[model samples]
Target: MADVLGLYNYWVVIFLMMTGFYIVISRRNLIKKVIGLSIFQTSVFLLYITIGKVRGGTAPIVADGFEVYSNPLPSVLILTAIVVGVATASVALALVVRIREAYETIEEDEIFEQDR
Candidate 1:
């Protein structure tokens, strides 16, 4: 029980990842697919944050008598990833809007059917 509690973050990450994957795989609506992609990205962000955390560690700032400092690299990388994800999501949604305009529906099957 103690170990399970200690690793709860990992469990949650796994659950979020699976849920997002399922949504993306099973849902045909363009907006729902975008939401799933966002959820998947969120799980990745949480995973990075969890990996960057150190027990009894201080921030990367140097101070007197601080021996353990968490690495700032992962956090920085995640920040960049977040920016890129937002940009990609916006573009994707824009495309979805165009798709809706062209096809009159956002469902994947409907879009393909209309394309035929």
Candidate 2:
């Protein structure tokens, strides 16, 4: 039970990831799909950050008293990913706006029906 409790964060990550994936796959609205992708991206970020955490660890700075220094690479990478994710989401939203303008509806099935 204690061992299972220790992995709570991982379990949360898994749940969020699956929920996001299910939203993306099952939703028909373009805006909803983008939201789902954002959720999925956020879960990935959480997973990476969680993985980077160290018990009894300090920041990766050289100090005489500190020995267990946490790695900074994962944090740095996540920062970059956050920037990219925001940009991608903005682009996706812009595309969705354009799609709504052209199709008069943001629903995937409606757009397809119009096309046909």
Candidate 3:
């Protein structure tokens, strides 16, 4: 049962990644693109967290008599990645807003037409 649950979680993460990628590639709306990017970033974080989990390990914090600590590297890496993702998302959203203001529309094709 536990293995099945773990596998299900992995599948969900994979689906999130694929869905996010498809949205980013196929959507024409600037806001939708940013949303997709955010989704993709979040899915990666989920992957990291999932990988970090131990079957029966405890927290990595050192204690007087603790044993079998889960790896902390993955959590730290994911934290850093999440911060970077937020920064990237913010910049992308700002660019989208600027494009909308300049072109009077959020559609990618419309923005490209205005650019040309």
TM-score per prediction, in order, is 0.88, 0.89, 0.86
Q: Can you tell me which runs of candidate 3 are displaced by over 4 Å?
A: 1-6
Better of 2 and 3 by TM-score: 2
Candidate 1, backbone clash total: 0
> What TM-score does structure 1 among the candidates reach?
0.88
lDDT of 1 by residue, 1-116 (tens): 99988899999999999999999999999999999999999999999988888989988899999999987888999999999999999999999999989889999998888778
lDDT, candidate 2, at 100? 87
Q: What is the per-residue lDDT of model 2 for residues 1-116, given as tens digits with 9 covering 90 to 100?
A: 98998799999999999999999999999989999999999999999988888889988779898889777888999999999999999999999999988989999999999999
lDDT of each: 0.94, 0.93, 0.89
Give the residue spans of candidate 1 off by over 4 A.
Answer: 1-3
What tens digits encode model 3's per-residue C-alpha lDDT throughout 1-116? Answer: 98897699789999999999999999999899889989988998998888888878888899877777888999999989989988988999899888778789999888788788
User: How many residue pairs clash in all the candidates, one count each?
Assistant: 0, 0, 0
TM-score winner between candidates 1 and 3: 1
